[model samples]
Target: MLAEYRQFVLPRQRGLHAEIIIIPTGELKVNIKEKNNSLKAEFDELYFHSAGKETELVCRDQLGTESVRWHLHLANDDARELAMLIESAEEEFEALMRDL
Candidate 1:
């Protein structure tokens, strides 16, 4: 998941830039078995940002919670186009999750 995200954002830069941060929540869940009655699981949060503004993308999932934020600093063009691109990416991510 992390790799995919990096690939998605790292290649596109026409004067725009983005950053991704992954933070571990350090929380775990336990399950009952018999001999091995517990399992280890980890949760994390993902933050995405561009320009300067921040936006939340994903916040609830089995792998952990994630959020994406985007900032747009438009110089000559309208910011709406950039906004649309971010929105499209968000939707694409959601669809990918569903497939998983």
Candidate 2:
């Protein structure tokens, strides 16, 4: 699979707690640590418009990787399904951002 959807709370570190929601892109590695009484997150993923435009989205063969990396190829109905996924994510994200 090209992507995996995962949501869970990160382990507590130092003095802070964190939560994470993984969005599809490739193999995501998230690390959370405490910093100044707050939470910090690190990952490999899609952020803003610059994401998903590089070799990160490429398949294992194309990337010459040891792991069997996956890639997505959407067409017609499949493309529509992707669109729906995005819309659904966006709707919830918008609600989340309302407090910002």
Candidate 3:
């Protein structure tokens, strides 16, 4: 366990929303929800690509069925926190890769 993040929700189309949770093991536990319906997805490896004021969480899940490219609209403070979390996740990922 290296780092963990608190839950954050971002709105999507048609009342859908994305709930993002960063685990200590560098895995993103995501829950896409709308009303009473929800779907969960996990990404063990994530790439946070930033451009201008937008940031994208890039990852592909198993079965070749789930593709994730979450566009995050974060406030200034939230963006800073997210950046720190991403750095921690990247460090943990690198350590795990080296161990393999």
Q: Considering every candidate listed, which one attains the maximal TM-score?
A: 3
lDDT of 1 by residue, 1-100 (tens): 2211221122223533333222122322322222233323222332233443323232234453342322223322223333344445556657777898
lDDT of each residue in 1-100, candidate 3, tens digit only: 5446354444224445556566645556656555444333354444466556555555655556566644344434455676687667778877887899
Question: How many steric clashes between backbone atoms does each model show?
Answer: 4, 0, 0
- Which candidate model has the greater TM-score, 1 or 3? 3
Model 2 misplacement above 4 A: 1-72
Deviation (Å) of 82 in candidate 1: 0.5
The local lDDT score (0 to 100) that residue 89 gets in candidate 1 is 53
Instruction: List, residue by residue over 1-100, the lDDT tens digit for candidate 2.
Output: 1233332222222333222233432223323334322222122222212133221222233333455333322223433443454445555556666766
- Native RMSD of candidate 1 (Å): 14.7
Cα deviation in Å at residue 88, candidate 1? Answer: 0.1
TM-score against native, each model: 0.28, 0.29, 0.46
Clashing pairs in 2: none
Q: For candidate 1, what is the TM-score?
A: 0.28
Stretches of candidate 3 off by over 4 Å are 1-5, 9-15, 35-44, 60-79, 89-100
